[model samples]
Target: MTVVDVPGSKSLTARALFLAAAADGVSTLRRPLASEDTEGFAAGLTALGYRVERTPERWSVQGSPAGPPHDTAEVYCRDGATTARFLPTLTAAGHGTYRFDASAQMRRRPVAPLTRALRALGVDVRHEESEGHHPLTVTADGVRGGELALDAGESSQYLTALLLLGPLTRDGLRITVTRLVSAPYVGITIAMMRAFGVTVSRENTSRGEVFSVPPGGYRAADYAIEPDASTASYFFAAAALTGHETTVPGLGRGALQGDLRFVDVLERMGARVRVDDDRTTVSGTGTLRGITVGMRDVSDTMPTLAAIAPYASGPVRIEDVGNTRVKECDRLAACAENLRALGVSVTTGEDWIEVSPGTPRPARIATRADHRIAMSFAVASLRTPGITFDDPGCVRKTFPAFHEVFARTRAAWGLAAAASPDR
Candidate 1:
């Protein structure tokens, strides 16, 4: 199959915004993905009184390394949880009264852990509606940052929010995390921070983890975003479903994305995985064998992996993904419900999900308005003829050209033409 170069990592986009907002001068970011999520983040920065210039290939953000806007203002983060989560911590470090509002999907995501952590750090953060959720009003009259404890079981973004803003606090900060999930994402944040010239010291403890950042500004450098490994998971699954070899280029050997572990998942499913410095090729063995996997470290690939599990020879049980329930949608439940609709034998718990192989059934898969769910089911459709997806455009939150890329990949692999559904 033809090699596809996916867009920039969403993880990198969020971290870049955090670094850019903390930089002294204009920081030019090249190849920033222009998806809805990144757009919302850029808009949030603008609302915070930063000048962000978006171009075809790059975005130049004129930063204020000192802090956020001093005046009181309302910033609407729309459906981007990254913006909604990260911006408040930055605002808390500055002297301002800020109001944050988000779309219905974003409002559904949990934010209480972050709010509580910010409050513990002596920031005045109040929930305007449905306490612990979004529509928040934060007043940063002053920030006392020393030692703060956080419950990050719901999202790593909460820890990342505090970590990114910790350097700007008066006393810097040390964050003690309790029950941290998505640990790999924390590694990504730390790596990106180092790239921006910020040093964060982390220590793993029995209670959970501790992170420390020294008070400093970010260094502006010409940085290039790597291809999204999370997005590549769908194509890797497609190879397994269609028994075709799919090569994805630009996901280098030195790629910093933790989602690269998705390749190992494919290998376990009987797909041949070839890796080089610049490309990853997944060739299917014409049949898949199921294996139980603990997904706590690579939880982001669970949806895509589960979508392909129904085609395996045995049961595929995915565990250690309790945090998926709190994502954009109840991903564990959504995966079970959608798979069941397609006539697959599926079971789900609060945290774990299991899928059994069965005859393919043609059905219209519901995406639940989650980008990964939409793309994962699309890859599943490659095996089940007549399978359709409802509201496929939901992928725009991360991969806007997903449908086009899928079509191109299908043509290259000699698969039948599939028409895009109207959102």
Candidate 2:
């Protein structure tokens, strides 16, 4: 079997970019992902008056914590919601007016929570289009941080934005989040903030609680990004569904990604899981049992697990994942609809999804333009006889080399390209 190394974590990349842009001195990031999302973040930093130099393996960003360009400039974030959400807060820390816009897909993504939080922090933010959405004009006078509550159930990007900007506020920020979903991603944010010399504390006593960010700027340090565990989930699922052993290197025992728990889910489904200091190995036991679990924290892996659920002997039910509705697509509906299209019995809800294992049916899977959907379904194709993805290129947003990785790994299972009709 041909082994492949996944790219750097997108979550880490975005946080690193923000930290590098806000730090006092020149900061270098090693093995930074150069996908569309990350490039958009770099571009946003440039528009905000930070000097960014990019190479194949590293990025050097010169910080301008002072603020955006001399003249008010417009920043286009394309389809990267991380850039659209976080850059506005950074821009608000500086002088001058900044207009932020994004692609239609990103524009449809909710920004109200973050905008409202920024307004509450004393920044002048106006929604140029629909209320609580993008096309924003932000004029930064200053910030007066205090107690604020944000509903970030839709997207964790809002909480991440507030956390990144909190240290810059005068009184340090006390953010209270209600109905907080995607808690794992918030963990990534907090860890990255700590690495950059910012302190944040979270209370677990109640669903609605406060987070405190100490008033200070980020410290420059040499940081290496861990391999993406979300991308590794597809490969682990491929191994589980196809009865092949797949070992993804670079994600060690104490990796930062919450999606790393997906390997444990696969193990519960009758796969063998091995974790080492620098790699994780998943080997199928040739049979999978159905599992019912609450995936609120690890919701990003729902599509990967759902894709492989058809290979199990019973039904797999995933719950506590209502936040998937606001992702690039309605992931619950996409999983149910695509699994049904493949002739599998499926049921879906506003927050949860269920899939019953059944005989494989050859079909063209629609990814709904979501990267995770494309990667997860492509992994599913390894076992399902004639599955093909309608738009396989959708994986470029995260793992640009996903198809190549699959081709290299397919040989271990005696698989070959099946004359893709969709291509």
Best candidate (score: TM-score): 1
Ten-residue region with minimum lDDT total, candidate 1: 414-423
Q: Candidate 1 at 416: error in angstroms? A: 1.6
Report the lDDT tens digits of candidate 2 across residue range 1-423: 336688999889999999888887888999988887888899888876778998989999887656555448889998888888899898877888999999888888888888888888889999988987789999986576888898988878899988988877777888888867878898899998898899799885464878989877777878888888998898888888877788888887878888999998988999999999988999888899998988988898999999988889999999988888888888899888889999999988878888998986878888888898888888878777688877888787887787877777786567876545247
CA lDDT of each candidate? 0.85, 0.84
List pairs with backbone clashes in candidate 1. none
Model 2 earns a TM-score of 0.96
TM-score of each: 0.97, 0.96
Clashes of each: 0, 0
| Residue lDDT tens for model 1, 1-423 | 557888888888878987888887778888888899999999889888988898868988877876675567788887888998998888886777899999999999889988888888889999987989899998886565799888888788888898888777778889888877888888888888888888899888886678888876677766777788999989988987788988888886777887888899889889899889998888988999989999987888999999989989999999999988878888999999889999999988878999999986878878888998988888887877677788888989999999888888888988887645552
Among the numbered candidates, top lDDT falls to 1
Provide the lDDT at 217 for model 1.
Answer: 60
Q: State the lDDT at 305 in candidate 2.
A: 91
